[model samples]
Target: MASREFKDHYREQRIFVNRTIAAVLVVFMMICVLAARYYYLQVVQHDVFSTLSDRNRMQLQPITPTRGLIYDRNGVLLADNQPTFSLTIVKERVSDMEETLTSLSDLIEITPEDLASFEKRLYQRRRSYESVTLKTRLTEDEIARIAVNRHLLSGVEVEAELIRYYPQGEDFAHMLGYVGRISEQELKNVDPANYSGTQYYGKLGVEGHYEELLHGKAGFQTVETDVRGRVLRVLEKVAPAPGADISLHIDTELQKVAVQALGERKGAVVAIDPSTGGILALVSTPSFDPNLFVTGIDTASYQALQSSPAIPLFNRALRGQYPPGSTIKPFIGLAGLDTEKVNTGTTVWDPGYYQLKGDDRKYRDWKRQGHGWVDLKAAIAESCDVYFYDLGYRMGVDPMFDYMYRFGFGQLTAYDIDNAREGILPSKEWKRGMKGLPWFPGDSINMSIGQGFMLTTPLQLATGAAVLANRGKWVAPRLIRTINEVEVTDVPSPEDVKVNQEWYWDYIIKAMEEVMHGRHGTARGSARGAEYRMAGKTGTAQVIGIKQGERYDADAIAEEYRDHGLYIGFAPVNNPRIALAVVVENGGGGSSAAAPVARKVFDAYLVGSTQLQAAN
Candidate 1:
């Protein structure tokens, strides 16, 4: 029995040993297979794995430049860039954008317009990257609400973006213009490589003209990220170059005052430094806020602006072409003196109307009881149509064209800013070329009196008046005083601009001075309280053809048929600093309607605010 038990125990030990060896072999084979697979992934497929790792662990982000600031002559901020929170979406991370957007809409009131705008931006930005601008300029309350619900909206993100802010708002609309998003058309125009991170461009006025100077170079950065595409840390970065700040020649205070001075009237006022050609104020009434246009104006709003009867979108300062009316008389009188077509003492008999040789078109005088036997000085004072009518016929077309060209008429001022319309300086050649008709003697007669095909923009008139103030010296119309404290470059030399003659200008200046200081001067009553002598001309452009028996009275005529009042002047008569042009559409007389505006401008420029306060 003992021997049998010993044998059984030895057999059991052998069986246990065999089972232990088999289990160890099985574990060894499994380890070998896992090790081989690991080797294959780590070494043979290293590049693919490395690429996947980079996709999860690295990111590239754009660093946008700060937009340049705009300041007026007084250092008041006009256009500024402010930081604001915008909602964005990362398309790759978004599982269901419609659901995410729907939930986001609950946090903040989202209009169909907002959704439409967002979708447009999304398509433009594409899905591989973050798409901006679901909601912009979010309020504090909205931001708080979004933050609380951020976990619920997986793909939604709140990011900081720069937005354009026009602090002065509607005050500097035309001059400051506005900045807006870069459109596909604008993108095509811009070099994609250069503007990789830039988002806005100037749309008009000074802003549009200096887009390159205002939009600075872009920048970039390489960042390390986690597996979930979260930025971990910056690996490399290049700082963006900031945009150049711009200082305009515009005076915001004077601009404000001028716009206010217009009240509800539709008109335009342009004032420039006669010596330097710096525009002090350019006001076009019925203006709109430029900020409204910064983020792509809606079709309805844009249509309203376009269709408004006041034509707010029309740049009257640069493009409104109207017969200069009596404003052309001073220049015409000067032309006569320069061409030796008429002397200062030259006289023409006026019985309230004038008639050409065979043409029965009686060019009637504004004064039914005309000034009899009027000289050049007397004619300018009374604005005697008969006197100018006689002189214009004698001066003829070619000579008048040459002399008018000297006064910056019928030509674009070519001011530093673009979009200035060259007003019609209707010459015999121009009439013949454009209309394909021979120049008529009657056309010259009418043009001489600032009528019939003779048109001048507000800018052109301001420049011409400045030329007269400069005594035929340097006068180039300027809108930008400095670009980032750097004086504007390549300003045209005043000495380069050719004028009639020095003696002629002297005589004309004396005559214009008399128009304000002279006892019989038309603008004399308007100049009574001014501390300084103002050389000016009063003009009333006839809006309708009058019958031989009709008398013009603004109250009697329809509003559309009423006369346009115009005034062009320079202050302190002898040595002028500020030259201005004012136009009041359908505002009856230049002396009554336009001269006061010029006087106020003169008060702002020649007589400083301190002086006005002291006097007050």
Candidate 2:
């Protein structure tokens, strides 16, 4: 009241007008700020937001490429790709993983094992949105059932993928190992981007060795999806590149024959072309079906294989290590000649046993009543243990190792023979280093006959045989003749074995020929009536060492503990075509068990029954 009494009307009005103007300006500033923000969002950052929205609306899917076909040299299919339906769950797309897994069980037969494997994959999974396989190799009826219930299934997909198949399952099981789901451990070693959409990878054998060439680049597809992340329709696609179709040097018919020849017996046979250095036939018995592992083997079946006494999973040809026995005699004989320790006229008095000049301990020959007098030729033909014993003792361990190594012993033999063992060629340094003991003279004597620490794979034996067939020339043994229809040209050439005297080759070969053709040859029985002149050496290796005064009766011992029969040979002594090695486990004699198999293999290749057709 007091203030009103003294107030001027114009002044009060002016103050009210000023406050109203201040309010108006504040509102205008806010409007400007809002307009600026709207302009920036709509125009400047437009592409970024739109792209993010599209990413949510359209999903990128993976298109697995069709796996490459694997064929034998004769155009016979070894590995193939088959169309199979798999019921899979994308964890991020699924509303509830466990519930969907249960729901899918109703449409098809889902065993407890399937659930267990699914859980294992989840634990091993690396990336998100990756499909978890619930059931694979689905039947047509099961696929139809899943398709009919598609609307109810949110994250589940019925993907038809090309899986690895082996028509020649048993024959090529170990040769071309099957693909399997990539494990976390395996995934770590691979390029994650390349393996994206590809669930399986090469697990073992040739498949494992050439995984890079066999597994092609994965492709991408832009797919439209609903709000629930369900794929609606494909918008765009990048086609997957299929893996290379490779042709192995494996001769299909010869492989079949080798398998048939080895039937039910646990062993290995490897045949090679001496001129080409191509592995004509590589066979290992007690083989499994490669198809069994293609779709992930069942637990019971896998366990059965694991528990099998025969070890069907083992690759005997390339991996099995056994005492080479008399198969090594020819190499040692050659060493003797080259070192000038012995000559063509070299003769040894064999009274069925050998001894050090001062020691009395007898190293007995195979024949108790031994050949009285054996020269180089007779020694090799008769497989005279005493003669080799004498030769080896004089040659010493160093020269033996050097000579054997030149023939590809104690080392891997081939450029393409993957995972093959190099076998043991014992020497003074090796014995001192590995066994922490001095090399005994007795070790030399034993190694001379391919005993003691000496060991060899069937493959190495075959390679050595081929080298011998080549007359001191070295040709690297290999399984791959061509890749993707192109000849494998990158393989390294091995230097020919050094020979001081070139004639030494012919002399050693003549002795080997005598083993198959001579009257008292050990393998004469196996070589009877052969159309072509052949050269061979038979071997009998003891599994368990026989103590002094103890005798080895093959029938008296356990089958696994008996001798391993081995044979190395080549046909048509002059122009050797096929060189091979055969091993028969617990078999009595090389002539009876392994040599006959070699003879059969030689005849199969030389008889001209199966011709090599132009590789398709």
Candidate whose TM-score is highest: 2
lDDT of 2 by residue, 87-147 (tens): 8888878778777877888777899888988888876745567787878988888988999
Per-candidate Cα lDDT values, in order, are 0.80, 0.87
1-616 in candidate 1: lDDT tens per residue? 5555336888899999999999999999999999999999999999999987776777667777888888877787988988888787777778888898888888898877778877876767322454567777789999999999877776677888888899988778887778887776787787676677566788888789888877777778878965445678999998888889988777777787788777777788998877678888888887898888776677789899999988887778888888998888877887788778888778899998899878777888888877899888788877888988888899888877876787788776556677778889888778888999998878888888888888888888888898888777656787777777888867764344344567777777777888887988888877887788888888888778777777776788778778888999987777786788998888888888888887777777666676333322
Candidate with maximal lDDT: 2
**Model 2 quality (TM-score):** 0.93
Model 1: lDDT of residue 157: 76
Weakest 10 consecutive residues of candidate 2 by summed lDDT? 607-616
Worst 10 residues of 1 by lDDT: 607-616
Distance from true location, Cα of 151 in model 2, Å: 1.5
RMSD of each: 6.3, 3.2
| Model 1 TM-score, 2 decimals | 0.88
What count of clashes does model 2 give? 0
**Model 2 Cα shift for residue 551 (angstroms):** 2.1
